[model samples]
Target: MGKKKASSHKFLALAAAAAIAVPAVSPAAVSAKEHSFKDVPARYTEAVAYLTNNGITKGLSPSQFGTNVSISRVDAAIQLAAALGIDPQGTYKNAGFKDVPKRGQWAVNALAEKGIISGKAAGLFGAYDAITRNETARLISLAYKLTIDETVKKTPFTDVNAQWAKYVDALVKSGVTEGKTSSRFGADDHLQRGEWALFLYRLAHPAAKELDLTIMHTNDTHAHIENAARKVTAIKEVRKAKPNNVLLDAGDVFSGTLYFNEYLGQADLNFMNLVGYDAMTFGNHEFDLGTKPLANFIAKAKFPFVSANVNFTSDENIKGLVTGGIAAAPKDGSVYDAIIKEVDGEKVGIFGLTTAETVDISSPGAGVMFEDYLEKSKKTVASLEKQGVNKIIALTHIGFKDGGGDNDVTLAKEVEGIDIIVGGHSHDLLKEPVLDTTGKEPTVIVQANEYNKYLGTLDVKFDKNGKVIGHAGKLIEIDAKGEDGTYILEDDPEAAEILATEYKPAIDAKKKTVVGKTAVALNGERADVRTKETNLGNLITDGMLEKAKTINKEAVIAVQNGGGIRASINEGDITLDEVLTVMPFGNALAIMNLTGAEIRAALENSVKEVPGQFGGFLQVSGLKFTYDSSKPVGERVKTVEVKKENGYVPLVDTESYVVATNTFTAKGGDGYSTFGKAYEEGRVSEPGFVDWEMFRDYIQANPNAAPELENRITDINQP
Candidate 1:
């Protein structure tokens, strides 16, 4: 919790040369009633009446409050004195000012004697002159004894001078004011009567104590439900400790393990619902299977989703769930640009942003359009502010410092009013909160890595003005183990039952169902597949080629990046689980048009780190290549050949050949810049056949398929 500075001070006046002290009288609590002043704006009505009822002001005539009129120095002193519970009629010695007026003579003289006021000149009090904002700040600070932090060297306001910086800082720190804008104090500007009344009312009634909020967040869970029970326990523990907490997920709950393949996202959604997520944003992977599955998932969700930039208008499936603009009363199983929730009597605003890269990286279909993240974020913040919500959060799936395209770090630096960023996409495990003080107010960014490994917890304290004054964060290891290799935290029984009885049986059965039979062990081991030609790599690429040809018969050659092949297949029966494990990312096959020279450049990149493990190591089908490791990196490929109907022919530099590869590599996953260029040039077409399904079909069609290297990728330097 942020320690609040002392804002309440008694108006103590000494005897003799000093003004007489007055005992404070507690004013009666005012009922909720509208005042007769027609000119007072609704925001300041209560404050204006509170001062009026306390005998501070009778108003200009009966109906007019003169809310915007510049308050003069004498009038300001009288009001400040009466609002401080001082008797303005008390007798006091003359203040020794020649031009002192008779109307507020006693109040001004009493305040001057108390050392709270000083004359504008040696003999002139400037009693009739309009008091400046700087004067108001100093008077309020002294009268209320607002705690001033002397160590603060500078404030957000650049215009405040050395003489009055502390006073202005005191008022801001005490939540009395945030200035006219973030950077401008308007210190020399004249004070309005209504503004001073509001300030005095705040001093009289300090805001409902500073709010301390705790947020438990997760992101990129990606169907890793094995430890979902333990994650539930961790979340429960946090909620037990901090009841004033909210649970949020930053997105990507769709793909990764066999659970998704068998149940789509239902299994993950059950656990998410059980754990009670307050809101979630869509990650790129959420659109992997297109709109129908996503629509079904949202329909069954217990909480709403926030996506400020994703427009679901054209899509009929999920468009009805969307309610654009800020939602004051958000509904469950729906989508909104932003939502406001009252947390512990304080209103907090939350909005979401999905990456624009989703169009190329995932299958959102044509109807689901993604807007520019940065531009949408600015409008979202402004909209939230207009709703009178000062405490705001951005739950985002944009990566953290992911180049410059779209990420959390860039969002924090560019946007001004966002208080906290619960981020994902890059799967960054920020052990501590990253504070961006570059903006007017601080923005705290946190991410809990990926795959349900950790549950991130952030505790933040906001002042009355909704400025983040203090924050602390950490990632709780969901599957933390004891010394004996036993789990440290007990699984939540309900969650465990849901997983064991509800989903695990089908998953186990699916794991055992044989997809195909292989005579020998497919060598997809990390070291072999990444460094040398493996039969598993050859099989995968051949499957990719076969699948690509079914959609586009022009595809002649196929290449699979070694990194996309995750596991080895044992000899004999190949179960469905084995296929999923080997190609777990669910990368779709894409065919790209490439010139022979461009193919040669891609080949050069494929073996650039030859003799060492390169994930981009090309696994070939319908092609052969010879390279000498003794040669330089770019010039390693000695010769390339393309398979014709009869046999292999030397590759023609100027000729174009249709090539097939997983979307990851075709989109430049492992520095395949040549292939990436082809993809960027719109020469690539996605048949959308998932890698594992293609491999499974290819093996099923030829049950006894056992691929062996035919010296397809020969290293001339090898013995």
Candidate 2:
């Protein structure tokens, strides 16, 4: 990527002295029913009327408008910059404010270059300081290059102290201070919203026109469908009030509750469809059930799933699921690409990507692979460019930079030719877009907070060449106030009747039945299990081992994949519903006999694909071993031991021991092919006992008790 030449049109400061004469109010100013400025001061009548006509300024109070309020330096800059027709995007050189953010300092510098107003000191801009009425008028006059008559003398003011003598004369000549009844200039007063509108209108357009483009968006949805519906309603109302509109999602649209888990993303897809989501991409949790389920979701979705680097071809299951017509093998690279659309006559290209950590921390069956995002993004952009896509958008499941190991920042810094990056995954809320330093192309990145609590809105403008001209974005909270519940499924009589007639009884029954109780919370999150032992996995495998022992006392080991334990048990009266959520899949327990050598081989094979990356290797009851990755494959297991009722016993190399695990791993999942080899000749038996039922019994017998997660599992020999 090559840097473009710097923009040469330096911003100039507004005039330090107020200038220009007030004009007569036109009929157009007061014709619109929405523009009522009865409380405006007499001196600002023309400016107020002009602003009201343009739809920029509306009085804050019906009877008493605060015209003497001071304006913050940043607010003043925003107003004056909009008046001057400058692009309010990109980074500017720092104006030497010790507290101003690096990103924020750009706006300050841009205001300074335009000579809107000088800072308190050289290289220092006190952005937080207030702007007085006279100061604002002068800045506005300078920004508009307005000139007042020099022959006019200072107007009479009872409180025109010595300090503002020169400014008073200039303001009087410009007719900006004619309504002032006293000598006081109200220098410390905060500027009101109405005052800002009047000032900007007078400075920019004596006769303003309504602005085009109204954008609405949401972020960090996390599958909270009901609240998302409310946000959509609010956005629609705003859209009805505006001329042009676009709706967008920042990301994190799936994976956070029983609804997502139970239906495997069907609920989220249905809700997003109701909200009319223009586009979305994967969040980290979107991979919770792995590639196959994710592809199933994409198949059902109407909107485009965008990502650049997530390659689905590496996993055969994912390839079959994402492709609509046929089941393809893992080698087909076409499944994991991007979607292009033409919205409102603008050629838009969207791509998606998730964090690389998802490969290890998510579900075991996510056979897809993640490549270097920047490299893959470049390829995607080039391909889109070849397809005549000039406006590119990245729907990223990456997250905001929290000074942590964030890949989104890396993507922003390395990737170029992107117009906007709608990001999620970290759950950080960004009210406005962050300009990346990738190139002069101006990439705007934004994200909303987690859950369906807020909606992000962005209004962007483009030139004839499809280059971004301007944009404004904000986050709107979805509180109950003015929430009409139009988007709610409960509001629909038919839907409510269906729920009452069909699903309500089943839901009530599931909730009422007590399954068991737990003294402590069980582990369910991927981070908890992939990197460490979990009580839930322990209890589950313990049940399997116990069941196997009943059939054969020789059973010495039990292992289950951490991914199978979907939910944690909090301290409470456990219900059947909770148990079902935890162990949703009805996987039968299987027992098999394997020698100590074969057991060690199975463990080695579990860690082979990505060493120390097996969440499925979690075991309970009998089994203890230290694995060193630096050693050769067959020699990695050291000090292999089995648990007896009394204590630990050394594993005999030739002695046959019964092992128990779920059918998934027994048949070979997570590359545990060594277990498959052992099962080929060993006797296998399926116990009729339901795994969840046994788990409930175990928890009931040991109330408030959780399995002890000792650091018995160790990793070694990493080169």
Candidate 3:
């Protein structure tokens, strides 16, 4: 437990100035109900003595302390902040709560800023809610950074659960006042004024030094080297503000733009080296080029790669570079596993875990094996704890679990002792770190928006026992609206030069090469394609269908997960670079034979998270479907029809259909297990073409592909 600094001099100074010892009226000074309570001043003698002695609370009148009356949570917050000598009369803005007044906002913000009291959902402080003993105790313990010394005996609370027991124990062991009951804590009872006074007073008495940790991170950067200069500038500013800090990259620093296409991730390596990344993990995209190119990228990368779960023992090209380290991966000359980093005399244990789904989605090759995520996380944390390192940060590529995959939140719940998770792959823009409510200590998980668009900074504070007490963070925007050249960062001259003289000319040349023309603009925005059908979705899926038809005579359908489409094509001439931007993953074509039942199941999967955009949301061609999104998942599809030579007809469940899609989805990339099963059943084949090339070719073949919302897929319930 961390000791707290006491500001008792304020109380002593007040006493000296007043020239008074205790409050003027002692227990014997006046009769109850007469001068104090107006009902029972004599009934609360000791409670009065404790409050006055600690200088925590003053009675309403000169002789009366409102011992029996309930206290509002907000009022309690103000009192506690005051007891800590933090005046909040008018310092903070809104206090991040809607109901709090500007005048009283600072106190609430102070407590919240320290991670003492978390508001109700939607950032509500519940100012007026009556706080029970258990709730109040938890907040107090958090604010004071109190930990139960295992050696100290328990407080024996009858009401609080095992989860709340340790906190209640800390409250009592602090020698703050004993609970309302000797053996049983009245956990559900409303906190009264006198009890509140005793609690705050005790919390303010301990004295100790504070520990601060600053973690700067990035995720899902996807090879945007131009924005790297700005990212470097942001880090320099952060280093100035916090001398003691760790810089980290959360992976996916590969793929997306021509930078990766031409340099094959080496361009990213040059910029990352200039930025001085402490460590990095292999996002699934890192394996897109199979192992040899990945091995080349790893050999040139200056930073260590960490991931305990991904075992790369098979690919001969990288195996020598990885399995036994050989100066290729993390830990100086070791392969890949957990690494211990020493920053400012603190032993910070770091580990990494990519989602196990990487095997099916990317070309990690048959050699690289991904272990179970939760299992690996648990083992790594235990290993760290055994090393006497309490502070642990998991640099993970396993994103926030929005789709049906193992994610940061699930990892937080299942793993113990992880203080922070710097995650990627989901491309979530977390304004603040997400804390794990289930863990013993706070486990913070954070991810910045993808494509080098935002640089995330997380400031964490740790107590004596190395438990995370509080954290604050924000995602810095990568560039100005609609412009890439203009960024918020002054370039690191070396990184800027690498982008300019080395990579820029090639990318610029390719960008100006016109490939095709479109009559109308494409809607490839995340919200549009992921949640609903768009003209761009129709066009891309048609490209896949046209390409698949050339290989297989029976290929009639093309399916593309909205996630595969990255950018919108404007009306007019479309450049090859623009096509690459629209389909950046370098995903290759795969032809699969799936039964209509499996196809319908895939449709059901697409609409499962309706009203919420899931990357797995299907955008298709040669098929039409109607779904009632308001209905429950698995039962949402109301009707499905397949286009035949004569007309569109109902899909036959028993009959198999020839379908084409990117290799990612064909192998069950984004929660599409139905397609994965078909792939595993030997019904899938690679058609020897990349997604962007195929798209360009199809666009060239058809001068003006339809860019209209044809209502191919719609919600039947919508009017």
Candidate 4:
């Protein structure tokens, strides 16, 4: 900001050109002593009217407002100095330059003292030198106190990078100036009086400039497009009322219900495009369909996608999207690290971070690697800072779990300068925002649970320094009334059309088919199923155990992968589509013969990523186990017992046991390689029943079946 140059002649030419092209409506061009002025019919009538009506500028004489003449440098300075209420009646000893006319010496010295302009050369004030566009930008920017660091790789102009980039970038960022052409600044151009008046008028009224950012966010939507219409309506309404409103999704808008099974992620993306999402990050399930499908989805996105980590080099499908560059040197048009968004005169930088666990529980396919979330996050923030962006946001799928590592909480604490985090993956229900002040400033984190039941609304207020000093966040229920008991969400007519014609047809036919009835609300939610025993988990595993018993009566225990259970079912007549939605993978039931020791090892593997939830966690039936997550991997399973004829019995290492699980896990999905080895040894048998079929059978046989935790699984280490 204090940069000094030995010569100002070249810059003066550029500044003069700018001043002439970018006109302001004022009579300053006709000389204060001249009388009649011409009424130029241009777009600046309102500004010129304001100047005349407010006495801010009187015509060069009585009638002429000098509407169409070249404005002199001294006239522009005098107008700006007067608007700022600076008393320029006193004489200055240096007079800013030797050439400053006696009548203008006070205004020139006053403006120079405020750093708005400088002499063209030693002792040469150049007060009469025509002001250029670049000069007008510099002076007005300084008047508004617009600060600039750097956010350009190359100047917008082919000829401007070396000398005029800083001034041009500042003026654009300030909302007071733009290049003569999209790719050229027209630096060596002079200012007409009209152009200079407009600049002066804007500088005079700095209060009109401001930014109010309203963010509508969702996370882990998981193909819950049924309620999407209402959410779309809500977003459109907010946008109608605000200027800088942005719509964002934290991730997992892919799998869960029959919607995803029948149409994959198409339904969600289509709806997202309809709602105009500004950006999105990758959720673990994004890789469940392999990198090719994920790339296809990304290609269809209308907006940019960001993720600081996750190497796309290993997969040919997504390699083209990875515009290779280091994290600190953000590449133009690349969404890998961070993106600078201009929102109503303010620059908001957004970056993304994915969960590292995608490697363990998700089938991202070969050639994909995840980088350290925290490390990449820090680098991205630093890069954004280098780009002159102070308001930074992290769009992450890394969740927020209490007492857990690598979650959003850790991110807020580790990465400084991040203003907010819109997150998902753990499917957390944050009715309000959680503010963490562990860093140099407060970091607000918000996640709107899972599904499309609600839209998260966050309003943040920043001081002039771009520091967030006030914020408010809330969940706006899509179909429910507001706290004041009035419905705030309306159904979008356009969204309804899309849902009926484009997105809902594939699953509509099966969505109504009944499977079985549930007495209690089955809980297969990602956050609960991965960390504890959910009734939905119990119900699914019960079906697997029943089927295994038919195969061998000796099959005493059953276990289902938590990842296989995708959604919860309300207490009612569950439909076949609902069953498929809860268990969408179409995994076949596979029975495995394992010794007690192998079973114990598999159970240990289940809880390996505990406390911080993992999809590999097992939901069991006909068996109960207690574990301490604080213990080492092999030692976490402190005790295990199998249900016997008389009662529960402690596992015997040499005892042969029959267990049931999905084919994917039996083939080592979710790090269950123990079962994989058993399958490879030909000790695993296919039960010939689809997983969802069992879910249907279990609910039919035990109508209104409400399975309880029953102390089947315990975390002894938990406080």
Best candidate (score: TM-score):
1
Reference-based TM-score of each model: 0.60, 0.43, 0.53, 0.52
Model 4: CA > 4 A from native: 1-211, 324-334, 402-405, 481-488, 511-539, 542-575, 578-719
- Per-residue error (Å), model 1, residue 250: 1.6
Candidate 1 lDDT score at position 616: 85
Residue 514 lDDT in candidate 4: 79
lDDT preference between candidates 1 and 2, better one: 1
- Cα TM-score of candidate 2: 0.43
Of the candidates numbered 2 and 4, which has the greater lDDT value?
4
Instruction: State the lDDT of candidate 3 residue by residue for 1-719, as single tens digits.
Output: 22122121211110101111222222444333344454225434544554444343455664556677787777677666655445444354445688765434677887777677778877788888878888887877776555655553345766767767777888777666577778778878899876675565444323223358788888777677776776777788888999778888777776666777778888888777777778887787788778877788778777677778888877777777663211111343234666666555445677888877576556788888988887777777665554345678899987575332577877788777788999887666689888876755678999986777787888888765667778898887766543565544677676667678888999888788887898889889999899888999998888888878876768888889999888898888999878877887667677888899999999999989988999999899999999998998899998889888887899999999999888778778898898878755656654324678778878899887666887889998777
What overall lDDT goes with each candidate model?
Answer: 0.81, 0.57, 0.72, 0.72
Prediction RMSDs, each to the true structure: 16.9, 22.6, 22.1, 18.8
Error of 1 at 159 (Å): 50
Please estimate how well model 3 matches the true structure, expressed as its whole-model Cα lDDT: 0.72
Q: Write model 2 residue lDDT over 1-719, tens digit each, in one string.
A: 56332122111112111112211122232332354445566667755654444332234444333455555676566545433434445455555656444434555666666565677776566676776665665665555444544453454664444454455565545444453456656544555655665555433322212234455666556555545445656666666776466565655455544445455667666656655666565665566556666767767766655555666666766565453211101112233355544344334566777666455435525456777777777777665554334566677765554211335666666776677777765555677777776676677787776566676766767554445668887776765454675433213343334435544454455555776777677776665555445677777777777766765577779887766777777776788778767776545456666777777777776555335445565555577677776787666667777888788888887988888876556656666776666544434443323456567667777776657776456676542
Error of 4 at 559 (Å): 9.4
Model 4 C-alpha lDDT per residue in residues 1-719, reported as the tens digit of each score: 11111111110000110011111234243333344345645666645754544334566545666666666777777666555545455445454488866656667787777677788898897777787777776677676556655565456677575555666777777555567788877676788766666665554333222346888898877777887778888888778876677787788876666787777787778878877888788888788778877887887777677788888887888888775322222332244666656566556777888877676546787788889987787777665553345677899987575211357877887777788899887556688899988855788999986667788999988654456788888888887987998756767888888888876776778678876787788898999899888888887888899977875678899998888888999998898878878887656566788999998999898888888788989999989999999988888998899998998999998989989887668777898878878765657654334577667777888877777767778899986
